[model samples]
Target: MPPAQSALVVGAGAVGVSCALQLARRGVAVTLIDRGPVGGGTSHGNAGAILRAASPIADPGIVWKVPSMLMDPTGPLAIRWRYLPRLAPWLLRFIVESRPERHRANADAIWLLGDQAPDAWRRQVRGAPAETLLSPVGWLKVYSSEASYRAAEGGRALYRARGAALEEFDAHELRQLEPNLAPIFARGVLHADGLFALNPRRLVELCAEAAVAQGAVIRQAEVVDVEADDARAAVTLADGDRLEADRLVLAAGAWSRGLAEKLGAKVPLETERGYHLMFETPERSLNRPVVWEDKSFVLCPMEHGLRLTSQVELAGLEAPPDFRRVETLIPMARRMLPSLAGAPTDRWLGFRPSLPDARPVVGPSPRAGAALLAFGHQHYGLSLAARTGEVVADMALGVDPGFDPTPLSAARWA
Candidate 1:
């Protein structure tokens, strides 16, 4: 296929904006479309950690805890009872991907893109006012029990095998590294290569602004359907308006499955509903992003306030916000940092576009060469957005991305 001269990208979140910026940089006339303002979706409310040490979401250990996780209402993973029937198929595939071999393959695939994430982001924000969003202060994971610390050895080994740098800190060392942390944590692991965003929303807005500055058009519209043939691609908005381009990109995040199916890619995508709580005034300040191992939640300092983000609710897009999940983080946050005693001032829920194998779809559509797929990064979407965008832009422009696209191909499920 020849390089694309014009492209229409659906979705205006981090990944979509990044893709548009990269495509524009490559001289492709690009138009970015989204239902709301840029970054108003999942890209806005997150822990804001540009995680470089992210393991595969499908861990072998999760297979054993699935029963308990499903049963416990306060557990990190929960499923609304009513959604079980619809979630069964995806749950089964998720379990299968939790096998040791599959877990490793998925982790390796994620690391391939993640290892370059910080650099990719650096390049994206270079000379831009939003450069302040990217912080290289690294991420810290704290464990409160010896058993829990020992249990993490396998994950540490995976990071080592992938050549990712990690620094182990005993309780004393951990306290010294983050003086504000409470004395409850027994151990800590620091990913020195990681980066954190001070304001994720601003980062996305900057990317969108950069894309527009580079000659990409920004349109606010809801894309209801997309169609592509051998020659060109077109997207139909909800208002019955249609737009055509030489190439199309589906980066709609959690809302992408329908559009992908319209293009004949039956991706088994599920929404991992994640919640976050923000404190207007934190009693204490954090040096960097820290994850409480036992609770599976993260507390990070952001420009607005201290943000506590985590929880995997296996509910579909239609479900209302379970503010209880956000409320639950309050006590947990206080326990992690006694200084976070203030009441949460804001709460949010966003759908993470997740695939069973924990890898994103970042290549061409099976049904049409004119359409490209770039969604489902799941937990790592923020981390991998820049790299995914670069690769997707390369595919659209017919340039070598310097890596194999097979692992991330949308046709893998087909």
Candidate 2:
């Protein structure tokens, strides 16, 4: 297939906007479309920390842990019992991905994107107000239990093997690093190269602005249907109008699987419904994003206030939001940070586009040469958006992306 001259990118979240920015920078005419405002989806309600040392969720032995995790009401992982039947196939694939060999491959693939994330972000936001968007204080993961801390050795070894910058801290040192945090932690690990966004939604908006400045068009319309052929790709909006482009990129995050199937790639994409609670703080609380390792939640200090982001509910897209999953974390959050006592000011529920293997589908559609796949980023969409954008742009422009994207290809499911 020839290089695309114009492209239609669906979704205006971090990944889609970043893709539009990269494509526009490469002189491709781009139309970025979304039903909601920029970043209003999962991109808006997240911890906002880009963890370089973070590993894939489907770690080895996770298969054995899922049942207990599902049983625990306060556990980080949850599944709607009614949705279990519908989610069985995806869960089976997830179990397969949790095998040691598959886990290792997925971890390595995740690191490939994570390792290049920071530099790609810098290049993407070169002329934008990056300082206002990003904080360099890094990410902190605190463990409250000795057993949990000990269980993290494998991940620590993985980080060391990957050459990711991280430092371990004793309980006293953890308290010293964040005085506001209670001294309940036994150990802490600081990912020194991590970066956090001050306001995640605004970050996506800025990326869209940057892309528009480069001649990319932003459209607020729902893509009702999509089609692709050897020559061109087109999308039909909810209003009955069709938009055509030389190529089509589906970066629609959680809502991408069906459209990808329409484009001739039947990917086993599932949504990891995540929830977050926002509390108003009169003053700044923490220096950076801090995660409770055992609880699997993060207390991120954002521009708006302190955010308690956590949970992985396995409800489908149409399921009602279960605010209780996040609401139950309040006591734990208060135990971690004594200052977080008042009722939450805001509660948010968003869907994370996840694949069983913990890798995104980031290359060309299997049977449609004119269509590209770029979703299934899972939890690291914000972290890997810039790098994924660069890869998508390179692929669309017929230029080398500098890395083998085989692990992230949808054909693995085929």
Q: Every model's Cα RMSD, please?
A: 1.2, 1.3
Give all candidates' CA lDDT scores.
0.89, 0.89
Candidate 1 minimal-lDDT segment of 10 residues: 323-332
User: Which whole-number lDDT from 0 to 100 does residue 43 have in model 2?
Assistant: 96
- Once model 1 is optimally superposed onto the true structure by TM-score, how far is the C-alpha of residue 266 displaced, in angstroms? 0.7
- Candidate 1 Cα errors over 4 Å, as ranges: none
- Model 1, residue 304: what's the lDDT? 84
> Would you list the clashing residue pairs of candidate 1?
none
